[model samples]
Target: MRLRPPTNMVDPRAKRYWMAGEAISNGVVTLVLGLLAFLIEPARPWLLLALGVALLIGIPYMIIMPIWRFRVHRWEITEDAVYTRSGWLWQEWRIAPMSRIQTVDTKRGPLEQAYRLSRVTVTTASAAGPLTIKGLDHEVAADLAEKLTEVTQANRGDAT
Candidate 1:
């Protein structure tokens, strides 16, 4: 099915957090690889050069890719369910039917708090079936959690 945009689509502040984290992670990987190369094969300068090149290439990709992906990402809440589609290369689409949701949780970490963003995790009875929606505004994430809880409770009432 064609993806639908989120009703409350706003510019996610979490992009900066993600980019910063990505850069740090890539930098660490580059450092470790450089160290390993130096210790194991000090003669091979090419390995260190390759790692440097990867770091240089990766930083820009980390910055730009998220913006592009976020532009393409969509979330839709229909009468019966909520659907989310995201990612560039390995696109993923997830559907959380109201009936299947057992609980909805909202969380924010130090980075997320600094960026004023949060993540919403929806849990189901089925093992390995929970879904998380990340990079949402803190307030929006809380609201989504409340709505999901309400929907799930209402569905349970109907079933009984």
Candidate 2:
């Protein structure tokens, strides 16, 4: 299936941030491996060289795969429900009917703050069951949370 973001929702910086984060994380791993190789003498040179090459190859792989996979992430909003599709290993899709939504929360962390992004979490009646959608513009996240809350409340005739 060719999954795509909603036409009305656009996150132009998602891929850039995703790739940058992967690069930073991979750099850290490479640094740790380099240090370990330096401390161990027996295979030090070979290990260091191998790790250097691996880091070079892995960096592109890490950045490209996630961004490509995320390009396939999609969500659709209908009159009474929202549908989401995501996953690299075990692809799956979920539909959350407005009537079944108990609450919606918008969250942002330090990194997300730097990126000006936020995550929206939707809670349902199932115990401890919540769906989290991330990498959204902060304002859009808040608006989505508000819209979800309004829809849920309208369906139930009660505010949560």
Using TM-score as the measure, which candidate wins? 2
C-alpha TM-score for every candidate? 0.78, 0.79
lDDT of candidate model 2 versus the reference: 0.73
CA RMSD of all predictions: 3.1, 3.4
**Which segments of model 1 are wrong by more than 4 Å?**
33-44, 157-160
lDDT string, candidate 1, 1-160, tens digits:
7755655443467567778778778978888888888787755587777787888888888988778776756666777887876676678878877777777899988877888888888777767566777788878888888887877877744321
Clashing residue pairs in candidate 1 are none
Where is model 2 more than 4 Å wrong at Cα? 1-10, 49-57, 127-129, 157-160
